[model samples]
Target: MTDYGNIDVEQFFTGDPIEDWLDLKRREDISTGTVDSLVQKLQTNSDGTAFQQFLSNRDVGVLDATVMDLYDYRDFIREVNSKREMKNKLSEVSTFYNDMRRLKQTDSNPAAFVLSRTDTRVKLPNREYHTVEAMGDFLAFIPHPQMQTMCLCYLKYGLRRGAVVNIDLCCVNIDDPRYRPILMNAISNFIGRYAAVRIPYIFTETSAQMMWLMVRNVATETSATTMSYFRSTTR
Candidate 1:
């Protein structure tokens, strides 16, 4: 027999198992927002029976619920809930069963069996793509040099916002007269250290020059050895 020494098994097995699971989640330091969402998804009765009451009516405890019972519940919710809401409900119940299994309270997770099909019910819309001319017009109107350089990087490299923000000065090699003034000033302190680094040029010469010009105009002090390529001047 498994030894559940000092474990309060009664907390999970007696009264409402859903409430017990939520209480345990609170003790585990789950964020209040997450716990409130779980409560809304699992216990709210705006449309029909609460999940706990539904299980109770069927004479099925959380540990004893079969995959078929969960499927029946899915059908019940489908009548009133949108496809996305139905999917979220199933996902939260699956998480509840998973936690019960971890505590050795049940041998099977019935909710897990049905979660795989939840995505097939919801159809996602196709993404729209912008034409090059449209993107160019948009870039032309962005008043700031920094914003223009960021848009150029996105256009050329398909870089995400975080990826663009995380770019370091040492990553690119710029060789343009427009950039020389700012580049000389920005890297004056790190000349010897980065001289032989030989990092390849990721940005086009024009974009690199624009980025350097933005950096020179915004930064009051250029003494740092290394810094992010794009940063807020207000800081």
Candidate 2:
């Protein structure tokens, strides 16, 4: 036998069906965090993980899954977890099977049938709406300038937390001739390190440019202060 030195073994393993599905997602440029969460959910069954117990069985391949098997899994999920969690888990499984169908690995998505059942059972409350006055009162309660600026940006732009945190110094471009009262463009790091996406924030009452300028100045000043404190402590 020929000796193969220091060859990575992972290249050959190729992972289980669940992992294989997640790998397909990664190839499509899905975020690592999102894919990892799906994998975790697939591996963690009510009794012993849906993937390991159902899809991984050689005798009962994914293509062989019927609506009854899916219903059994749904009952198992409901037994082990809350209704909300069950809905979420079933949704993930449905998405996985749907994607598998798209890949021509399966002819039907049993998970989709199960998901529809769960959706009908779950009744989530309506999302709360905050008025302008309520928002003003909340803003007045915040003490830190950086936190206030960040919150204002999020409120004004309806940005997610990840988007708000990803705003970079380069995102501030007041000198551009096309610059309106709004920041026009803000960089959000929602897609992890792969790329920075442009997100625009519109100002209805407050000056968007001024808000961004404050964000930049406060963020820089806060960073400098924190570093200075760390240096002093270290010295």
Candidate 3:
């Protein structure tokens, strides 16, 4: 009907969710951002079918799976699938694949059948030091102020990524007897080792006092020298 300029709709999508989900690869993590995005966009089974058709037409032998399964072993699955040689042999691959038609039939681990294809699960942590650019790209999804604080604590203090949320002033002190020495001890041991500090979130009255006292002591120390002889040393 009407003439329209050549436009690619693929350029329109921002891929924010996909990027967030993919970033987990650096941390040995997995997320259902892709499936969740699909589920949210695909309200009915027919929508899933449409996607299935698209995959099939593309000769992608992908199989349907739940969220949990995907998270548990996304890395291994990704590695195996990413083989460039396989592209020439196979159009697509499945983690729990079977080759019953072959003379030497084989089946994948049975546990794989029950695994979820959607969810967040991490079996390992990234061992190699993350480059600044890589970490920035991974953390860029989180922009909220408080969330940024939480992320910083993870990168700076080495706290577990998710555990940062439950903590408040009560449960954390740079010098609490239960926590301070341990963290300091860890830091002293790992001046450059970069160990993480994990503090259980257990708020209490003592923690409040301890933190306050530490702050007061710090203020007193810093000002003590500055305030001394302020009126007249020369006079």
Candidate 4:
């Protein structure tokens, strides 16, 4: 939603005020952020025409109608009640209209604007991390060269750590001289497992598994040294 946007607000409460309901929901043990976001999403719909129409039809000269007045029979009330299905769509339509308005090229509705609160959460862009000493110790453990070569081979071929530890069969190909003899075998599913399906790889010995191990050792050591400095500083 645009920060510069505002429109006159009209409130409609068919059975109960929505904000009151949100207040009650917030009083429970549920997530505070969820409650806040829900209220914010609803408040975004200030320019809803159908909402305005619903309010317009029901507006009294004064807010003096008794509880019994709502149930009292009127022909137009029955017609309006028949259109109850349309009320919920107003939020969605208003959002769509606002999207068009932001383009500022073709949207004709000068009055249309979304009034939602801006998201407070912001994600910073990704950047390379500085290396330190602990990272070297961890990498040192990988190139142990004794364990059956599968441990080092797995990482050497760029396979995941978990996959390296778990694979017993053809994952570590011992006979191939041209390749690193380690292969990426399996990953799981989207809704199901931690990762989905297998991605296959065949790396030549020329791919330099030994060099990768050396680099990993250097990086891990550098990271660990950095962490030790921070620990001392904090203490």
- Judging by TM-score against the true structure, name the best candidate: 1
Give TM-scores for every candidate, taking all chains together and pairing residue i with residue i. Answer: 0.20, 0.19, 0.16, 0.17
Give me the displacement of residue 162 in model 3, in angstroms: 39
Off by over 4 Å in 2: 1-122, 157-235
Q: What is the lDDT of residue 198 in candidate 3?
A: 44
Report the number of the highest-lDDT candidate. Answer: 1
The ten-residue window of minimal lDDT in model 1 covers: 217-226
Q: What is residue 64's positional error in candidate 1, in angstroms? A: 27
The sequence of per-residue lDDT tens digits that candidate 4 reaches over residues 44-112 is: 554454434344456732256555544543444677676765766787677766766676624454333
* Per-residue lDDT value at 48 in model 3: 57
Candidate 4 similarity to native, TM-score: 0.17
Ranking by lDDT: 1, 2, 4, 3
Model 3, 153-210: lDDT tens digits are 4454342322232211222322334554554454345323322344223223333333
After the best TM-score superposition of candidate 3, give how far the Cα of residue 81 lies from its true spot, in angstroms.
86
Better of 2 and 4 by lDDT: 2
Go through the candidates in order and give each one's C-alpha lDDT. Answer: 0.55, 0.53, 0.42, 0.44
Question: 1 or 4, which is superior by TM-score?
Answer: 1
